[model samples]
Target: MSVDNSKDLMMIDNGEGDEPLSQRQLNPIFASVLEARLARRQVLKGSMGAAMLGFLGVGLAGCKSDSDSDEPVTDPGTEQPPVEQPPAELLGFKAVSVSSADQIVVPEGYSHAVIIPWGTPISGALPAFSLASTGEDQADQVGNHHDGMHFYPIDGSSTDGLLVLNHEYIEPRFMHLSAAGQSLGSGGVPAFDAQVGRPVDEVLKEINAHGVSIVRIAKAQDGSWEVVQSPFNRRITGLTRMELTGPVRGSDFVKTLYSPQGTATRGTLNNCGSGPTPWGTYMAAEENWAGYFRNGATETNPAPREHARYGVPSANGRYGWELAADGSDRFVRFDASENGASAETDYRNEPNCFGWMVEIDPFDPDSTPKKRTALGRFGHEGVVFAPVTEGQPVVCYSGDDSRFEYIYKFVSAGTYNAATADGSLLDEGTLYVARFNEDGTGTWLPLVYGENGLHEDNGFYSQADVLVNTRTAADFLGATPMDRPEWGAVDPANGDVYFTLTNNSRRTEEQVNAANPRAANLHGHIIRWAEQDANHAATSFEWDIFLKGGDSGESGVATNIGYDPKGDRLDADNVLSSPDGLWIDPDSRVWIQMDSGATDPFGNCAMLVADPNTGTVKRFLVGPISNEITGITMTPDQRTLFINVQHPGSGTSGAEFAAGNYVSRWPDFDDSLPPRSSTVVIWKDDGGVVGS
Candidate 1:
């Protein structure tokens, strides 16, 4: 797929942390495999058995595909495993070596294929991927910078399913051919020329590129996967109509020129990590969305508390989308200044419409996505729901992906009954922010309107106001300021919750606490907790640092900071830096994806699998350069794994871009094409569970 936004990604990739890959012993299984192949070769060299054995499939393990050339993809031997599943919890594959190459690197015997890249046609008129595609065409094609994906199997068939993913943001220079290497804005964004403004169609096209894509995909008879045309293929973009649900639905905070009643809004911006609901729905988290809106209000006349708390810009917006040459209302909405006769006459309340978890029905193309405000709004990095019980309160957790931000959980007021529960359960819930105590126990500080300082005296008017100012409310309650908390996952076996604190370059030694032990957490860490008595709705819990992500010298906690062991640094087989995307499969293997700007010694961002109990982590895959490895999922049978590679070959210099070159031209190494973000389907040669 054709995608853009190199500069935007370059900005985020400018973090601190680097490391070298450690060496590991090759799997002894290879010796046995070689012997078996040799012994059989003489007996069946000319028989049908030899013809069907496909040497590539049964070849020795631990070899990476040579993606740089036109060589055929290397598959595991032709022998398929039995229908009965093998051991599902073991990390069977050997750790892959560190790589900074501009190609995907999976364990030997595991093959991966790039699927829907940005601009890949799946619905509507099925427009082909091209730099000249119109904004209208983008809405009908795959969006850019794919993130947070999941595959919903059709009738439980692992080979067929709906592949859904979120398109985070875009790079105007790379997205628009007219501005290539020209008119650069902050962080390499496409700037608005005061004399010419921005082309209305270009801005529209970018907006259309930021949202969600649901495409049906199926495995071909030859083992490769392809996009399947289905009625469910759809794109939900920034211009799509979405209803606001929960306490803030009709609240004045979201009132705008387009929706005075405040019951609905246009767009879902900055979608980063997401989760699938127990009821077969999808929830996309809005992260770093504040930069999309601007308020002209000066420092002396600052924007509203909601906007100010979330870092809404006081000047130009991120893309300056509001400066579209035609100055359309949809474009103007990006300007949230209180310039009208009142907020109702302008887009003053527009910023309030974002930063909430949006729920969409992948199977129902016509269903309007719902913004579940009861989950509380902030810089939502992603969401993870606790395993549901027949009649227990629905519980889910989310992290605000900014330095010093807090983690929060929402417990539904109404108990969950799978047969009847829906988004409404999220509409009436008690949202609680976390407070990490040095005593190894954590508290869930409730954000209910009249509780604690969250009342009129503190400027909170109602539940809606509390949620709108969730960060501020959490601050008043002395919630733990984290190291830029990102994605979270809950262990299906134990209900323990794990969160990735992806570094905080600002915290000082004076601010380091037990939960966040490092002052300048250059290489972030993961923290996990088990609810009291193993109850998801428990208000108190025990917590500890799962591990500190760093190179050899910088890895591990050296002091007994509370509950965890005081020592055990990252070894060669499992070195990592800014741990970001996280997921716990059904078998309890902890999957970690990296996202760091300065991933030197460690090469580019990579994926790893870990034993939650032993704190043992091993590299699983390494991605292309200037790319952040995020978003992951697998088929129901766990035979096929899907992960997203975003902003491949990013961080191209203006000069380099002007010269029509990029850091990488991955997925399609053609020199004429820019780097693109796309979904990758990975499978083992023997049809075994991934990671095993």
Candidate 2:
């Protein structure tokens, strides 16, 4: 789905005033100029190549002709080391082909089974899911639109684990219940607004569906995974009470009536991408959260500049939830209008409480979730940390997940001590925005108030203000505006960070640069960078385009020098567009998942595996039509893989639903059942390691 551009605002400094720039207007002209300078330097270096060679006492060797003889020349006194072959497991299965089937397609030797689908009951007391299930029932059952997920092994046991999932958003047609007590095709496309105006129960259900779910899943005696009832199984809905931690906890920006001290708040919305901490916790990201709030454009005192920058709308919210206030603070908080004299007396600051990285402890159901604000928030896609080492400060990287947004990193103030490390380690950190130079280098500019014009003179008063308005701070630091950056993964063996810059159609030819070279880039690309001296906490780094997403048949497909498969040719099977989900497995192979739309050249969304060293990408699996392949994880043994198929048959219309002409009926494939998002488990039929 296209992001709401108005919500993804970019305030640019153009010398006259802070002009709002659309994604297309926020070009990489600075990067282009830097690239021109680098090109000139390269020309100068080439001019002195001969002189440098002479100074090094090396002779210039000319190409030998075939007439010089094709005889083998060997040095008699020197011995050559034998070539070592990669393990068979390193080079596993062959790549699959592009598929448009209305089902999950895996490699030839692999088999898949549905582990959990939307509305599956996990709590022991919850009733089994059915068309007649109530809104309260769904609060305890599995949520809709499963996006990012992670598997945490139970006591380090590979056979059992806690599955943590993020339910991004809902399909109203599939979720709203009818007056006749039926759910499927009850209210249609307008159900989202209808639920907010009346039937407040339906709004409650959606609120419950928008957060995170933690359930215990274990391998049965037959080797299939099954949800087991345990105390660990819990649903953290939009109404759940959570504590605010770090810099912005008691700041004025987050002083809502519900949280007068700004120490706590209720719920997390739009949980998109996710990650797991080394200390066994889940980090759920809040993306596209601005649409949930109504900012009241006609209000006497408008929202502050920071609020506008984050795209809190100046009118009714996307779902109009505020209309269902009905004398309760729950629904009323969605309206960010100045209802009282001060911020603490109303819900004006409620929008500020969201758009953060919420840390949840899956092992302890009673533990309250924490919103770690020190990480700096701005539509956080996800946060992936480098491999943790004792005595070294932990470093985590995150993408802003919006058009023309910036990527950020957080280096903890304290050194990691695995025994005592927890979410508290994330509480104190220096947030920095990445500035990618066109000369194949990048810098992490500190967002500290006094360090880089992030002071009152530049409209920032405190660190909390800087952290709350991170996008504005990044703009002041002159960070490179990127394509929609979705997910980031770090190579375990080599400390290289890889990020998926999902398509940016707004970019024009004038915006293309050495890093982002595509104009009107519909097919996105992945970029990887190695920090200075392989140090995760370093401010400087070297980077290059890992691979470009496009059809192999298309001419002039852009690719970096070393990534070209065969003298600038791209392998057909490796062609994929709009890369989104990314994961670096324990074996060090990078698994890339695509989020291609219907208009994309690739037939359906797919998951591909790549040898990071070779840049050889091969398709692994494909989802049903109009579905996004997201939320990937694997067992400790690497024998079982879990993948989420979200919003199968998403564009089904009201007429189509009434006519029983569904686009996709996946997982169950039953004509009587409505399509639902699901998580599928894939493993080799021979019980070997996945991809083997």
Candidate 3:
């Protein structure tokens, strides 16, 4: 019934510098659940149900620890050295159980804390935050929504590192004290008339809060992980200046009235899941950006085909950012405007700025991010690259984060040279779309110029046309429709590619297929594809459904995921639901993160670990109420895990909220401190490898 059985940490409240001390033992509630599962195995061992796999193979499931197993917390100062581990070996990683709570929960011997929360000021000069602050105040602080993150260890240091985190989308209610709680922009237009919408200052404020934040993190010798105050910490928001790069550099499509030569843009927005390139660059995907712009009809030669590729409607802007500034024309032009006096000067090129994969070198804080247009984009959620090897094409796979969109891959033109471990060799590449043939096999269809259905008569006039309007180009060649693809992670051991198809509601019951079986699909599944013979540039691959979500018993059979109907591992018994963010640790254990939206009946989202080699799943941690568990990664040493809890208590309003009894008061539940959305690290009490 429960997983964690650890006792609550005894916190010292000395008003300053005091931290919580964990009492090393399982949480009582989780201890009981583990015992029940063990006891059930004993009773059913010889019974009719025992005839199943666990009863016939290896041995029956049983509990390993008892009352005598209660271990004492050891001081980290005198702890022995951590043994080095191979990438395929788990070392001492153990799947400890954790107690379930409406708020954040972790396993025994592990501790968590909120490191940085929404609206937390990064700049020392910015004023401290108050939840009651107006939209103006939110501008100077950390953005409201937090998503994908990466932890890079400081060179030659064991306890210090850098954190690059995405702020994702903004929450208007929490950011601005608005009455209806929605952002009040007049749809991407300039607010020349104060009566039009939210002030331009407000629009710019939100834009400035929607990108990435970098901070220094440290794990003290005592085993406590905290944010280190330093000048390296900075925020890159929607208003931040950025430069463009790649084959399409200086292209006409990228040209804007603001930058006629197409060299730069404002910022990255709607960022979703991400990956790290072989050369240590962070690749953050911008998902669902089509909703942010408004289209004005004043342009002369609008490209309808190009506009449809990005889902830009020929009407007013969606988010209304134009009314805030005079050149507000820049905000709503993604609408495929061609009403310009001449073809050379038309605004149809506006939509080209977005949908490209952006590569940010986190190490070089001052470097301009490169929008790798060579890797065609369509609501990108992630860019997972195959491991680099000498003379092998550097390949990266990505999922288009929209219902019925297609998955894509980019194969480098030059072979990956381990000699140059730097990323320069990745500049040129060939992009391909996927086609899942009937009979279970699939092929990577090339979207190259002059390829089948890519000619001028097919709507794509040239190679630039195919790259700029990627979606229509894919549609022209008939790429298979996938169920709302999200994040992707590659298994280090087997090299299997796992992607999350975060439920799509548009499919009707009759449309249900083996890959996407459910109509409403409240519970999503993890799809793993193994490229043909480890060739990242291969043209074909085989796939299988690794796991699907549903309650056990007769209900889960519909998912056909090899679920044990009468076992304790049933979906109802286990809390792992709606897999979203994903990562594969050194040992190949798939770490799953969830983004439980409105349709998710589960209280809050959580994280779990699954041994892909064995299909054994275990819940790891629970997020704060109303929060999404996202951005998971393990330190190179595998001694620590970093995860983000975003938008906790999101639905609370002025009328129903309270200071002490709010929807969630995580990390400081007793009203001792104000709570904020944050990233946390969970490690064992003995300073052992995390998850061991």
Candidate 4:
């Protein structure tokens, strides 16, 4: 049977509806606001039926429908300008319309080029790229499905820099090189059956395809960017050795046969979003790492709660990797079963070694990646640090990417030292989870042991246990559960932190809170908060909705579920949905990227620019069909913008590929060769600041 691209490619929630995580009730004030908003929406639905509502360009309460009339209810040109305009720096960019094109569509006067593709060689002797390349060949080449990325300037020059990118996941239909009529056993064919194990070679190739890649890119004399092979180029794959640092280092929860002391592990998987530190290191987050392991339910000594909480099935692994063990410890490590007498004799604890903020020194090719555990472990979408002060403690914020998960913050115990501070600063810190009160007030509840029932009386025995099982500790403290929280961006001008609450389809009306208003929030929204006294280290905060993403033609009354709507929606550009990736440049301009599915009517996923101060958003660029526009970064001078087009023809099936009915053949646009995810660089035709 062929894979279903629509259901398979989308984000999976393996731990859905296991247990209630939050015990605290929603804030009454916020609950009242939601009640009133829903009441008004009901009244509107009663007064104006679906047909009349569409003509008025007003969206129905819970569903979306096409409007019969193309004309706007009120021409935007007739409205008077606001008394106070946004800063002059935020204006002047022409908005691009939503599109389903096979190319990257940017505003007029801007140009883009595919700089680095999945098979590009970055180090040693340049190797030719072909689908027929062996697993060893891809082990030395670029990985697949480019997600988050950053640009580190070389010698402080914008013209030359190191580009670091994360290989989020792989699309098997395009990765393997099979003969014209080969029976798909392995060799790149995806194995979905538990009885049928993948070929060891195919598994090895996939293992080499799931980590981070760093390459040097430079601007040519023609002002276009090109990948240059340099000594700094390196690839950190799933087989790479990684050190486990911070409080959980050498803990009993992480001890395994490979590393009895638990100080190290092999590989970083599902690296999604990332953050660059002030100390010149890259922090990559490991998301969705649980599915890789398999724990049999029939084990005589089973750890069901542990496996269930992390969403690892007891019967079979997500990819059936353990079936290819073949007496090798490398492959057997994925089998988290009680084959051995004790946990230390098997790989039962291997899953605990992942799901962390891994720190890698991009400048040092030989540096060891450290998993900073004091930041607390969950399904971390990414970690974004607040602007560092000379003497203040470094503060980092992260969001758990599961539906109804909590947002977290970590304040380092040590003060900033520009000359010598490194990942050690992250070793000792206060890991706090957010508790958003109903009255627009929030508090950061510490997850430290013995502070709030996080002691021996509860399941947590020490701080390490609290850090290891962060979700349970947060749940014990009644932290507020939120919609699927994804990437976070910290504003440079102000200390305000913004997070993208990517939509939650499983969230019901009763589960809706002040922060997550919509019952079934299909089109996600962005939420921003300012720490008390403008200090990121503070335990309290004040927040408000920044933007509500939906159809621009939605009625004002129906859309007024959050903050005031005077300047919220960007009607001219039709904005976007499912806001997944976000970045704030040095100039304080907010860049928003989308990861909506194929069903979205606003066309394919796109990127937008937002004025945080004025809450004004405009579409800057739209990606190709079925591709997610992610990994936003810019040059030091802010002249060039880099973004990743992930899985362009994402929902394509293996049978479809064999039958020549693929969804998209992007980047190359050549039907002869399979499409590949790549990094594209955008720059103004005339040398001006991007979005200026």
- Return the candidate ranking by lDDT, descending: 1, 2, 4, 3
C-alpha RMSD for every candidate: 15.1, 6.6, 14.6, 9.4
Model 1, span 193-258: residue lDDT tens: 788788888889999999999999999999999999999999999999999999998888888889
Q: Across residues 341-381, which tens digit of lDDT does each residue of candidate 4 receive?
A: 87789998888898899999988999999999999888888
Tell me, by TM-score, which candidate is best. Answer: 2
TM-score each candidate.
0.86, 0.88, 0.78, 0.86
Candidate with more favorable, higher TM-score: 1 or 3: 1
For all candidates, what are the clash counts?
Answer: 11, 0, 37, 1
Please report the TM-score between candidate 4 and the true structure: 0.86
Predicted structure 2, TM vs. truth: 0.88
Ranking by TM-score: 2, 4, 1, 3
N/CA/C clash count, model 4: 1
Model 2 off-target regions past 4 Å?
Answer: 1-28, 31-89, 179-196, 553-561, 564-568
Off by over 4 Å in 3: 1-102, 124-127, 131-141, 177-196, 297-303, 313-318, 325-348, 421-423, 553-569, 572-575, 598-601, 653-662, 665-675
Ten consecutive residues with minimal summed lDDT in candidate 4? Answer: 1-10
lDDT of each model, Cα atoms only? Answer: 0.79, 0.76, 0.62, 0.75
